[model samples]
Target chain A: MGDVTVTKSPDGVWCLCRLVRERLKAEVEEMKSQFSGFRPGLVVLQVGDRDDSNLYISSKLKAAAEIGIDAKHLRLPNTTTQDEVLQSILSVNQNLSVHGLIVQLPLDSVSSIDTELITNAVCPEKDVDGLSCMNAGKLSRGDLSDCFIPCTPNGCMELIRQTGVSVAGKHAVVIGRSKIVGAPMHDLLLWNHATVTTCHSKTLDLPEQVGRADVLVVGAGRAEMVRGEWLKEGAVVIDCGINHIPDETKLSGKRVVGDVHYASANQRAGFITPVPGGVGPMTVAMLMESALRVTLCSLTGGRRHGNSSGVVNRK
Target chain B: MGDVTVTKSPDGVWCLCRLVRERLKAEVEEMKSQFSGFRPGLVVLQVGDRDDSNLYISSKLKAAAEIGIDAKHLRLPNTTTQDEVLQSILSVNQNLSVHGLIVQLPLDSVSSIDTELITNAVCPEKDVDGLSCMNAGKLSRGDLSDCFIPCTPNGCMELIRQTGVSVAGKHAVVIGRSKIVGAPMHDLLLWNHATVTTCHSKTLDLPEQVGRADVLVVGAGRAEMVRGEWLKEGAVVIDCGINHIPDETKLSGKRVVGDVHYASANQRAGFITPVPGGVGPMTVAMLMESALRVTLCSLTGGRRHGNSSGVVNRK
Candidate 1:
């Protein structure tokens, strides 16, 4: 047997994230200059005082501000009525200046308003979160022309493409089936001509199925559920899951980890994304890009008809 | 090795087709009886004299009639302008009696009419073919309540459910990526919680991929492209392709064949559907059902708010 060495190279997550962010920032600056007094606006609606939700909202707002986009965070009480929240969404949707709208997830579990109803309330054109039935439907139909793709999945695709790995003809395995991530990811991969297999909680023999993938994307939401040996050698791994686990080594006694056991995956995978530095940054960047796109479309009259030619080249 | 008996069961294409047809007919009859002088109407728009298109239109019209629905076939010349076709679609869409509209496929290839534009022109409420971007998008988002699913994929799902096989957690491999068949089929399977893999022309090692499927759905539109050994033992095969191959033994010099080499597949697959008898009959049955659904919705006044509850339970 010949001796073989597997080099564990960094997947360049930070570099790619910076590149995407810088490009979006440049576009935002250009748009501002092209149209005097034009500022891309985003309204984020948050219900309840959940710490995590507040944290996410602040980060999103900060990111938007950094890119020279005006971001508004609308906070609602946990006991707010369903109609009240919906009315707020409708008002924001009607605002000509507010080009993008997002309802922070994990609303009070007991809230009377249905999550789906609220999601659909946002205007499709300005739905930066891409959770509306209209956007999801457009994405599924392989019509990327006017739809806002969900941020995390869009980011995952961007990262995968950055690796210079051709997605077409590759056996891609996606683990998860959430409407926000797994389902759309599967659709995107299929649209890109990758032979895609989706695995979820119901999937039996997960490891065996994952082993077949040349490109494995795990978003099952469980921390380190996927072990190293489960992945095929030389596989391109993208982890979209972010779960906080107790860690004695950390000062805060907690650490963020992905669905994959990164150490083990790194040993075998040709490319593997780290939990904190990888998909998280990309998600925010994609959201900024989506917001900019909506703003541009609004400034130039109604929705742009064909594929997204302005910023995100889906093809 | 101990002697073991493996009984190859009949896929029951005819039985399932008849069952679905009878149910749809019953629903149509019930609606007719409940609402006096109410006749569900369907308009099929065919843009060419293609023999295959003519055959499909006739079959659809006949099926609608058998179910107590009024159907009209609008034949347009090959030289018909795009504007004329769109105008026809818009007129039929506005008709109060017309509950279903289908633009027959393979519209004159040389014609300048854009198929996508024409398909989208049909009111989503009356688009029985489910080729409209709106219907396709809704179906992809797992929101089946209001959208009409594409007939072939709906038929394939119905057929799979009829077999008494549990689809959840099963590894399903779908061949082809057409918007009408393969793409929607993948979405339906994924929505049903199956581990779905979509293979297309770009796919390498097709046979190996096929071998991994517990359920294999082929719609590549090629005749006998998949052979027996490619399938996993005891695999349930759903062949959606309908191709005519020249045959010396047949009086017509052509015989209908599916994407799979049926004679060989039958030896290994636990259940296998035949080309002519399998998915063909179900497509017409599904169209009749879709028309009835639209008719019922109109009678009830406007689109039904929730999941399809009356006749077609896509779930």
Candidate 2:
């Protein structure tokens, strides 16, 4: 028996947690069937060993191994030249054995971010991360006819749907405009029929924007960046931030929490995904799903089992 | 020559409009110079005998020819098989002379909307219209790295920017989810940093969605679909609809109006782009622009004009 609401209209209950588990089960089985012996390889390139980035990669590699995927964490020194990074990416892109490639961000930056150079060599086919600008544009236009949507944002949607919030016709506001979360979140919401507003550092009156959202996804890293009073009544809240702030009572002297103050925000939020068990784990799981999807797609004539809503052609 | 807003932001008014105009003028002239005896070509595959579709195709062909772009309209009978229709598209798609290809919509009942088939067959490099699903996704994800954005929607944004409304950090609501306008408009808005919402027939409380928009774009076929009372104060409106409504004053007995009740909406709108002269002409113009862009892109190492804002360096 599931504790969440039925798979129809989201009244007052959240069930996406169960749905996510079910989907992971279904995808694992389906992918296994499609990929009998075709093990996929994932190359995660991280520059300058940031502790958080190291932890994220380590977890991703662990997830990959658990899912029977060949995953590697390619770490380079902070002093590594841009050409060296590009050359390493070129090899991963050119390697026929690799099915998915992801370059971890927050690259040792002093100048402008050269997204073009970093992702330039990534072949569109094995670009499971969808960091490539080409894929970003593809998702924006809903021309998913040949693009890998970024996994985390894509996973966020998948997780939200589990709570049974029908995205169609809803007003969704995504906080933060990072390429990884906010930008792609805007497109995904638009694709699913949610009227989307993306707020960032530049947006005036962030609270006013937040107040209008029927579905609010917060990804800004600052602790409790969104106040409880700003949330709309009965809104579905997805907290994607994993931040560490000093908490005097805690043993480690710091506590991890999401961008939204969950306790105060929960009074009005009809459905909320928790921090430690919420988007953090779902992201890694979804990347596995994407790697599997890449393999299945490369195998089966490009049409997936649940492609589109299958509503239009029913008539 | 410009009506600068003197009340709120004095430091902001720096002949920005004139400066942008000068830059665009130089770019346009630069593009025109590259046309040295280059004959652009557009091939249209029109299935069935729908009078409206034919008229639309003919006008596009005329526009193409007027611009020194060779245009051809091929008529395939209603009874033509899907394969035959597809083959005709292939011929145009493969021809090096045909730089742009458009398959007019509403193909007869016999030929299912195999629009996808025709679009898929056309090479991405020559997909000047950007109707291909692959390119559409690229636009949606805010990645213009290697894809051509859709013509009509691209035009809508240019017209909106032309109105002196800054899209960055504004709230924009787009009506209709048609691939042509609503979808691409949403992507363009996201790319420009406006929080965007997309509404369609399935949307609930549509007026509430419209009221939140700092920028409103209406493309639905229904006349007077958007009410003037729902508009936000000082909002900019762009009407893409071309509905024929009864007008006793007109000699033909009817007149063209947009999705919004224009006369009433304009009272509330700060700057509104008229349906007849506003976006309609620009759509055709953008198609020419797309053709120009793709031609230049194919010209080995040919860089777009000095300010190719089209590029998405997502770092």
Best-matching candidate per lDDT: 1
Tell me each candidate's RMSD, in Å, in order: 4.0, 6.3
TM-score for predicted model 1 compared with the true structure: 0.90
- Candidate 2 - CAPRI tier? acceptable
Q: Tell me how candidate 1 scores on lDDT.
A: 0.81
Candidate 1: what's its TM-score on chain B?
Answer: 0.92
lDDT of 2 at B114: 63
Model number with the top TM-score: 1
Q: What is the lDDT of residue B113 in candidate 2?
A: 58
Q: Which interface RMSD values do the candidates have, in the order shown? A: 1.5, 3.1
Error of 2 at B159 (Å): 2.6
Query: For residue B37, what is the lDDT in candidate 1?
Result: 65
Candidate 2 local lDDT, A57-100, one digit each (tens): 98889877766778888887887878788888888878877878
**For residues B60-149, could you state the per-residue lDDT of candidate 2 as single tens digits?**
776665555667888888989888877887787788877777777767647565666667677766777777766765565555655676
lDDT of 1 by residue, B1-315 (tens): 011122333346777667767887888778877997688998898997999888888888888777788999999988899998989988998888888899998787456878878888988888887787767776776666668878888788777766666678889999997889988888788777788889999899899999988888999989999999888888888999889999999999989899999999998887778888788888888777788877888898756332221123532
